[model samples]
Target chain A: MSHTRYRVMEAGEARRFPPEAMARIEKILTRYPTKQAALLPVLWVAQETWGWISKEAGEEVARVLDLPPSHVDGVLTFYTMYNLRPVGKHLLQVCTSISCHLNGAESLLERCGKRLGIGLEETTADGKFTLVEVECIAGCDRAPSMMVNDQYFEPMDAGKLDALLDRLSREA
Target chain B: MEKVLTARIGKKDSRSIDTYLADGGYTGVKRVLTSGMTPEQVIEEVKKANVRGRGGAGFSAGVKWGFLPKDTKGKPIYLFCNADESEPGTFKDRLLMENDPHQLIEGMILASYAIRCRNAYIYIRGEFYDGARILERAIGEAYAKGYLGEKILGSRFSLDITVHRGAGAYICGEETGLIESIEGKRGQPRIKPPFPAVSGAFAAPTIVNNVETLCCVKHVIDRGAEWFLKIGRNEKNAGPKLFCISGHVNRPGVYEAAMGLPLKDLIFGAEYAQGMKGGKKIKAVIPGGASAPMLTAAEIDDCPLDFDGVAAKGSMLGSAAIVVINEDACIVDVAKNLSKFFSHESCGQCTPCREGTPWLYKVLTRIEAGQGRMEDIDLLARICNQMANGMTICVFADAAIAPPLSSVTKFRAEYEHHVTQKRCLVGARAAELVTV
Candidate 1:
């Protein structure tokens, strides 16, 4: 395969991973009934340490989990949470379920799209916010809801959303 | 008027099938069959009631029923009841099946009649062993009573309601995936376009609804649509809903409440959630079900409990399984636990979900293990960004990714400290933290 195309975690950064984390990764390797079972959690740790799962980091998780790197890569790509690239600080998750749709969630999404200056799957240029249209957040009674940085903000309107952005911006 | 949704499970006396029949169980079937009520009238009544599907997605039940092709060339039509109550913090379906099996049977009969189907299947999860048995017994009872089987209620309608058990896969809760599993296939999702309405079980027209959704049909007809519409607080979305409350709440069971009720009232009010356990204040809440985004303390205040209200806040009013998070619970631990579930449950069908869930889990485990870095938090966010959008067949992939992404984003400093200081902020499972 071509090593030039894949992003590799730097050695300096790898060295900064807490020794205990490395030890725990080793422990996770032993604790699992099978090495493959440990693959997901190991990649999770790598993604945690690196901010995203790079191809190199994925290979390392694969090694620790005692599986092929390709297997790890496949698992990483299947879930929506495992980011392969960089993203902004605030992750905006909008629910686009049936109830949300009826409750004008689409309009809220449009407003968010316009304000964030990015499409549904696109991240902002400044890497401050990445707008995402997610599946049901399961608060149908509170339709037109959103999760900013994992905290639920209900009954959002244009005004409240703008304020939320302002607050998140300050925090970021 | 004891709200039927959360009534005692198999009270066996007053609420048993015999009691239910005495109180007019299978009467709807009789009424529909004898009263000459066409399927269109039943569907129209359901539409007027504005009844929504109770299984996570609040799609109108009547609208869904209307979608089935009016006429088919004698191809078997199927009515599927989603008894797969696998979503974490969701238990109402199990309770309903265990308690009032007759209500469900009647609902299935009515639903089957409206959809012009001969066979109906109640796909219960393997874990709900007792519930499945109860349903089988109920089906047997309905058969003896002549409500089900060839020539139901002595009318031309003959329906067979089968109780099929799932081998424990959450993806089977999805309609198409459920259909796939019903056919004895490996429970993975099929692409849309040939939706269940067009090509469902055995490639015949099918209608899949939650157990609660099917049950609501009985009420929508018995009480008339106006009475049903009057129950919910939201005019647009009507009908009573069951709130399954767990985690840190004083009353951690299912409660029936009008739609559009505020979350604060549900959580803090004396009779509702009644605050957290041990008299502790609620610090956070996963307002919908497990998959809904986590809610902070301030945001929990006065948030409405309906689909529209939840959507307004960028969340969803999913199955309405309210999971309360107390002050002491570490957000990282929450993320780690949720990550473990999605990772284990991933069908390994889609590339992103199959791989991303475990990767997200690893990062969360590392952080919880006191090995997180500043970049690790961002990396968590990055993976969540990638995994949370259109990456898989169902929302399970998104469900797995959102928690860690949200946790790291919300509590970055805590994660940063764990990495820098080499310790979990919370003492729970500290040894496991170091065990990789």
Candidate 2:
């Protein structure tokens, strides 16, 4: 039951958003009547920029949206996608819900574990991929779906898995 | 059996506003605004059409819109589109959002006009990254074309649309939970009696409608109510419906057919699923999303695929997410998979849902893994009873109980087999211990 502890980055050491991201953040903020409504999107921008949501990034988001740091952490932890710890370059999320299960999502997951040389929720030694089983990604029509980062790879099998991993390795 | 909502889905540049305009889109809003039709008249048209919410509740959309108070001196009415398509087996809305984003925009604009709201928001699921990008571009197009954001069609009426993305909470699919999420809080449902129409989203008169329901609103205005009424099997269940047939089907995709279409046709018809994969015999069918109870092979024989039709057969067509299980599949494993999903997704706000869901999953997992005694079956039933029928803030608890309760009752023999034999009977060679 031991959990990996993440080093808390202080506010002074937090990476600031680039000029383009800052502008985009402002544009997103204008869409909502209240600055607080932009909390989730702002967190997304931070995660996209920093690879994962660090403690300082959370504080920065809180400061920009004028929310309490504790409030930002609570919201960030409540969601599964916002990774608090740094993950591998590619996050391979496989769907093992009922629809996907009926279509061999279990074996596909096993294949992913075997091929990646990592267990569920475990990252590879080289930090290339992290395999995790997710709930339905709403791709039931194309059962046995998996998401590599933000892109969805559906109706997948052993062959597709090999090709996908190879391509991702090349890109990395 | 004509496709009004998804007709332009697969075409080239289908997501563009220009394509939508060329194919007679935005006419509904134009007709409502320029024709000087009052909001009351628009509501009357929707009421006549009998369009129901497609976000699993199946409540009348017109009746829901009517719940808002007439007095709006200090309060601003808001419309929130429930685009969080996270129901386990549902993916029809993803198609609409990805391919025909403008149809939804038009629908939202028209619905906002009907509700007399200046601002509307599309609360989409975070996992739908591609769909969210598509919707954002579509909203931009809408604003540029003067279809959204102030003085639509050069009239006094003005409306603004915003697309908000949810991080990754399934409970946000619930309307009240969605409101809380948008308000920068945990996605948890609030108590009823002061419904969203009365006080929602920043303490304003808010109205939340499913993406499909609003799209139906657009068609109701464009094609007239009578045409919609004539498309379904009965008056109560009218309009073309999208049946998301997934799982062991040969052709697993979204099939748009008339309401109350026979379940058998959707599963076996060439236009639909075309029959079970590997030519296996149908074992069981989850007629709705994971929330709805499962129907056995014999029981689903003549059942119609509509809210009332499926409800009459002892299951609700919640989201029309049909997951077909073949003979090779084990019911115990299916139950365990769904129970795990509900347990993981439970917001843990209420004691029953937060505690009972994981408990059900634990027990079901034990039974599925062939480590259960006879007393454990009764324990599972008792736990399900504690979670059902208005025991919690939302129906998440009720949904969490559906798989174990219904599957145990109908497929008790399977559960008994897993208990007595200490191993799975069906698909034993293929079955592996699911690690989640």
Indicate which candidate wins on TM-score.
2
For model 1, the superposed segments whose C-alpha errors exceed 4 Å read A1-172, B7-15, B424-436
Residue B15 lDDT in model 2?
A: 91
Worst 10 residues of 1 chain B by lDDT: B427-436
Q: All candidates' lDDT scores?
A: 0.72, 0.87
Q: Relative to the unseen true structure, what is the C-alpha lDDT of residue B329 in candidate 2, on a scale of 0 to 100?
A: 79
Residues A1-172 of candidate 2 have per-residue lDDT tens digits of 0012233554447667888889989999887878888898899899888898888888889988889999998888888888877789999999999888887898999988998889977889999999888888999988899999999999898899889999998884
